[model samples]
Target: MALTIKEENQFKYIDEGAGEVLLLLHGLFGALSNWEGVVNHFKSNYRVVIPLLPIYDMPLKKAGLDGLNSFVEDFVKLKALNQMTLIGNSLGGHVGLIYTLNNPDKVKNLVLTGSSGLFENSMGGSFPKRGSYEYIKERVAYTFYDPETATKELVDEVFETTKSIPKCLRIVAIAKSAQRHNMAKEIPKIQHPTLLVWGLNDTITPPLVGHEFNKLIPNSELHFIDKCCHAPMMERPEKFNKILSEFLETRPNDS
Candidate 1:
């Protein structure tokens, strides 16, 4: 099903279903389509919201995790979201970590996959190479355990984004900021029940990153999907959704 994009004030997002809230945040290069599977599966029983992160258009100085966190906070307040499950991937997870740390009362549960608060390889080693479709294709393919997961359309989208100098600059800035801002000291204070779903073959964040997250977060558990890489939800949605479903079910009812 093609999801509708609702525009309210300065925010543009996909808000589907109604009941409990499941706010999904995508990575630096990610789009709303990244959570298509999650939305389709959960919209029947829960509200699945995916906000289009202004990664390319945000001010160059604020083109990092902190800025993204602020955007999410403002969006949440505008939508009056509360006691929600905040799910994030890659940089989005990093942003979610910061937001949850700052507003713990708003978030009841946290879910992260291939997150990059601790560390990440970033775009398969280096910044995006402009004017090189082949290089972009190769880097996008490196995101999944199966190279076939990197469809031509997906490659084209990323290639188009990299072709612009301004977007490339912002992407690089955010990537660098994520690397510099490590949350090893702060994540342990997160009291919300957290879930870490990682890819066994993830090269960007790697399996060790997942282990580190589980070790640092006091109330968190880790699960790894075999034969998957960075974007588990896009590559292994069925498995990712199953793990997430079970996790969500275990959350205690709000009093």
Candidate 2:
């Protein structure tokens, strides 16, 4: 039986630590394992719950997009999470955005790193559409500043996740959702204090997107990390930790 939820798309979760609740959602091609470096930092001060997104296993027959929606619903329902802080990276960031928009009162703070919800506005060039292999190639290249930083291991990991059944379904679901899902309209309505963290050299989402988010969302703050690319948490954990800790600690009250 699944420890977290009853859905067919099972998630491996680490339900440890205590204090204020901090739910971490990973981006596309990412799992809870990716957040290992950051979880410990928050463990002592918060109840850190890292949910492994539906990437590897496929338990349901529904479209991957609906499955994701279900995943979020199940997560919120399974635990009485209130006044919690939600943090997401990459595709996970996109998910977090939607989660907050839907359940604004549930989230006290929002943190998105190198998120991927905005339209194509790259300083380098336009991104390829979602389906083609060239699109994947360009996205991979765009996510990093230094080409050499895109190690073979990273490439292989990316490919493995994309080629999987669950991920493919998820891609289709998110793409469909993105075409019509414009959080821009609801941005002004989001009352949670938000932190938008972006890599200055990020070509995928670009710093402009973060700025746009900051401008649209009422109480949002943007922090740009120079000399970094798409994955700021992974590219520079020390800085990421410092910024994150400061934000969570200074949130006035649990609200």
Candidate 3:
């Protein structure tokens, strides 16, 4: 079950189970369900919250880094979440980083996958034509090393969600802003224990970026998955979950 908290907090989210909170944030053009497999694995052990980020569905209110951060803060406060283990992918990772920096006391640990806000600004892709099946197929293919992982149902679902040109344009704008963002300097300020996961075959953010993150973020670790792409959780759920389980289960937190 879900309920709207605030005007700025337009995230479609899921909150379930008990114990410590697992706050899952999705990437651009992604919804809450993107982390379904991961959430299911951890829900029994921890309360899970996977929010459908506002980037996927354009809200009447304009969104930026500040707005996104505010939305997350409100969501957390509304739910009275504490000692959260934040796990985000792609753009969601970028947002989570910003939030943790501002509210470090609320978070116990962090995990980012195929996250944006690294060195590069431009997201390379042949968008083809908007609202077309071919465009969806190309995007799905581009995100995964093995195109076969993006099943027809998944592609079709993305297509239906992203059919509107105006919405797509908003997403493009959000992506552009994400690309322009340079969190290199701010990332080091984060003192929370962090785990960086990346796909070896990921062309979107690339595996090298994970290494860079490991260096910049003091309390951080990096894990590489072979034959995977940007969406590791979706493409290789079992392996991704195992690595995440080890990190979340055993990592010692200062708090």
Error of 2 at 154 (Å): 3.4
Better of 2 and 3 by lDDT: 3
Ranking by lDDT: 1, 3, 2
Q: What is the lDDT of residue 25 in candidate 1?
A: 96
- TM-score winner: 1
Per candidate, the number of residue pairs that clash is 0, 1, 0
Q: What is the C-alpha lDDT of each candidate?
A: 0.93, 0.71, 0.79
How big is the positional error of residue 189 in model 3, measured in Å on the Cα after superposition? 0.8
lDDT of 2 by residue, 18-77 (tens): 888888888665656567767767778788887777644545465344466568768767
TM-score list, all predictions? 0.97, 0.81, 0.89
Per-residue lDDT tens digits for candidate 1, residues 1-255, read 787999999889999999899999999889899899999999999989999999989999998888888999999999999998999999999999999999999999999999999999887225646888888889889999999999998999998998888888889888888989999999999999999999999999999999999999999999999999999999999999999999999998775
What candidate 3 gets wrong by more than 4 Å, as runs, is: 1-11, 56-61, 120-128, 252-255
Residue 207, model 2: Cα distance from true site in angstroms: 0.7
lDDT of 3: 0.79
After superposition, the stretches of candidate 1 with alpha carbons farther than 4 Å from their true spots are: 124-128
Q: How displaced is residue 5 in candidate 3, in Å?
A: 15
